[model samples]
Target chain A: MSDFIEKFSSISLNDIKNVPESDFPELTAEEKALASQAVTYSNRIEDADSISNLNDSLRNKTFIVGNKPSKADLLVFEKVFKVASKWSSVEDVSKHRHIIRWVDLIQNTLVNVPESEKLKVSLDIEVPREIKE
Target chain B: MVVTLTVAAKAPLVPYGSLIATEFVNRSNGDGKIDLQVVDQKSVDSADANSASKLTTSDGKEIKGEADVLKELGKLFPDVLQEVSKSQDLIDTAQNNLSIKNFKELATHLEKLDAHLNFRSFMLFHKCTVADIAVWGVLRANALMGSIIKNEVYVNVSRWYNFLAADERFDAAIQNFTKSLAELKKSEKLSKGKKESHKA
Candidate 1:
């Protein structure tokens, strides 16, 4: 139980935001415009399709860029769960086969962050301690 | 599909969402189009100020900055300012308001936002979609903001941001925004340096 709690506790959302911006340099105006369009289209599609399935699928799947799960997976997974818990519509969609498979995969594969390593990362000060408690 | 686009600006700061929305509309080739509606609040305010100095209100009251404008513009034009204010509110409430100390934490927040946006469903539905474009745009903007700010405490946000930044689709956009931001920062520094040198 402590291990599970620690693993969950160790996962911080802020880590997800910083990694990429640091790696990529600046973009051109045209590129920025295109990227913005791409993201907008992506959201529209999600809204049009099975929002529930999308949310559930996201929760279940590990965001493994290559073979192994990266911090990306953790970043996405946490939000998916948060939203799922928040919205009833999304929770209902979690019943889908693909959604279930994806969530299970994340929980089974990526839930293990060693206790010692977990201690090293700082908890977000803004996050209510009572939530973890 | 017929797409309508609008570009609205209030003042010094362009609402990040509006900026991203405009960028998205511009990027969408023929699939959908945007009609930009630029509401210059600064100009409107200035006009109001000028009018206030000229005459008293019909209600026997002195005009003021926002009040004069509201009185003269009626309900329609004032709505634009209301929208802008709402956007500003979102910015104020943005979760990543804190200056992050660790890169990992930033990455986490970015990823969480990304997931909340739900890009995969967009990909699943339409080959080229607005959601994809919007998410990518916001993510790129966030990346640039994070870089400029230099507080990488949000590991998840940073990691997710990096993932998109490295992707081929976003590579160009990320680079472009970053370059512009970097150039702006450089010019700012150069000007500051020149000012110091002048003082010396």
Candidate 2:
């Protein structure tokens, strides 16, 4: 029973989704897209252009690359927070209102994230409480 | 100037308290990066130990105290706590204890540290902290300690002190202070010899 738990525990949701469709029929194409998008954006988290793109995508969404919280959001937030945490200037943060809202939601929602694991973004850009069309 | 250097590089933070990477640290000690122009307010009485060292910040703010100087320098870094190494509270006590000129109190400080050294290898931890550096720096600058520390009065302190003195990190700062003092003494002797020749 312990051996079964250890084997399954090591296999995260990300690993299951990444295997070939034949190996795992439960893996949906949309979930694959979400995880892939997270990897792509996380790789370029340093580029300002990628930050703006992330801003646009996160306008109506709560998380970065998924409908709800998952490893996808965790992946991007870990990288993006390191970059966005440095955006202290009014002009810098205000340029991407969506990012501020998303960063705020992600940071406030995540409970177990240790300070050493990821940096917390600290800026006041007057972001609206709710997203408006 | 970027403050809070590894006490590892410089043997002791000079008498002014902490290493400020000042231009005044002679050519050999000046690392170019941390060097800043320090206007040393030449106190009238050179023997006056109570006079506080002062630093004029880039913003024209006056900062005093060795601990405060280190923290102010730490603020220059993105993460102050990460940059400034631990046991500042320990260093603070060392700074105050060493600054006491009275022989009775000075011995007490030495005795306390000697006792503490009995329990741990270093001042506060298994490894060297700024407390060790700060205390060592203060002792290094005091002429009386040079003679007193030579004898095994505080055996634990002498052992720990010798260990720190051997480290190459503290060598640069130690050499800087020692060299400057030697130069000053040499120049004084030369001037005295000239005066005697003129009289003869």
Candidate 3:
């Protein structure tokens, strides 16, 4: 699995809360910086031109990370594809054919191979160890 | 056609569903041309399961992803293409701007949005387009930044926001989501209390 997929798998829904502070996993300084950059990249998605530019840039690539759809593709897709329909038109999609192809691949595979099915098959969530007195 | 849109009440992307529902309602004008029903999935997991954009068409075609649904909608209403497409840019900008963790950066975005709203009631033309719905829905769905909106941080955006808040369609779209979220939180607290009592 890719680094993001591993890290994201470690995080449970409990880690996400309305209130800021929570028992999230410890991250290295580099990971923290990457998180910040992700936020910036997420923000940039609001601009159609910026997204179009990104799509154009990624036209040659099969996915954002590796040939297969990784958590990286999912993350970016959540931000871009989630809101693309509400804002983007046919023209925009035609302009960014690569993005559409990438989005379709993820959406299709994700539906066919549901995450719940994966969790059912694997014991990914760790149990808490007993505390030492 | 009957379209069912399911979403988590508090999901960050909730606004997308709400905005689309708002547009459908406004354009339909009780003509029954489109029947869009917004369903709130209380649990976060259930919401995330089909979070993209879960739209079941009249013919039982389950379509996921925000882009896919909008494309379908655009095909039905060709005039909405330009407005919806333009609104995507504004919505994207708002999502990024709203994610600004630093106050300084947030203020800069607020100023820009305020200026955009200056002397304008809606984001695009004189009428309420998908752009207005998208921007308004984003800010409204986000309670943290929603404070800025409620506090009237940006004069023009606030004014425009208030105008939409009073709209029947806008209010109608949010009424159920707000109520469902509150109920979900209440049940969560109850369940937490039960767990604590069991431990005690």
Ranking by TM-score: 3, 2, 1
- State the lDDT of candidate 2 residue by residue for A1-133, as single tens digits: 1011112222222343343423221325786686677669778878877888887666434444333344555556666766776776656665665565555544544323444643344332243222122
Model 3 TM: 0.46
Candidate 2 residues lying further than 4 Å off, grouped into runs, are A1-133, B1-17, B20-32, B36-52, B74-86, B181-200
Best-fitting candidate, scored by TM-score: 3
Candidate 3, residues A1-133: lDDT per residue as tens digits?
1112212333222222222322233444554544445435756887776676656534434445322233454456556655555524444444554455455444433222344422111111122211113
DockQ top scorer: 1
> What is the interface root-mean-square deviation of candidate 2?
26.2
Error of 1 at B198 (Å): 12
Q: What tens-digit string does per-residue lDDT give for candidate 3 at B1-200? A: 44665455545456454444534555553533444444445323453453544556678877654444554554445443336666677756765575465677777787777655432435764355656655675566555567676665664566567656655566766776566567777776787886664674
Against the reference, the lDDT scores of all candidates come to: 0.35, 0.50, 0.51
Clashing pairs in 2: B8-B169, B9-B169, B10-B170, B11-B170
- Error in Å for residue B148 of model 1: 8.4
lDDT of 2 by residue, B97-155 (tens): 87566789788787666655432334643334445656776777665677666674765
